[model samples]
Target: MKTLYDVQQLLKKFGIYVYVGKRIWDIEVMALELDHLYKAKIISNKEFVSAKLVLTHEHKIEELKIKKLNNGGGL
Candidate 1:
């Protein structure tokens, strides 16, 4: 997860392919483009909402569960 390639591969496994730029600054531009497309009705509201929920809830829950497991030390 240290590199963009790692993130791309992880996302691809979930059927998402993000065209990330070489530099970190490009992520904002890409996000803006995505917002514009959604605003123009190119992307559905369902897709946007689902993506937001997955990024927020799914990832956080998984990370927290893992942390709890590790801290419990095989409990």
Candidate 2:
């Protein structure tokens, strides 16, 4: 998918909804779910790779924001 929202929408189409009270946790859960779907052949390799990349990128961005905030940079 092009963005995290797009990946979430794709998961929604499969009746998957995940939340763990934290954004990073939620993204991790989504990644796990995507892996399962890929293994089960429910999604194509291209779709899985695309979604994974989006998730990873978003996760990194979130982490960087947290780091910046922790470093007293007001994000």
Best-fitting candidate, measured by lDDT?
2
Best by TM-score: 2
lDDT string for model 2 (4-70, tens) is 8999998999999998898988999999999999999999999999999999999999899888888
Query: Model 1: per-residue lDDT, tens digit, 2-67?
Result: 433443454455465555543333344334544655688766776545444444444456567767
Measured on C-alpha atoms, candidate 1 has an lDDT of 0.50
Cand. 2 Cα-lDDT:
0.94
Tally clashes: model 2. 0
Total backbone collisions, model 1: 0
Q: What is the lDDT of residue 22 in candidate 2?
A: 85
Error of 2 at 39 (Å): 0.7
Return the lDDT, model 2, position 53.
98
How many Å off is the CA of 44 in candidate 1?
2.1
Q: What is the C-alpha RMSD of each candidate to the true structure, in Å?
A: 9.1, 1.5
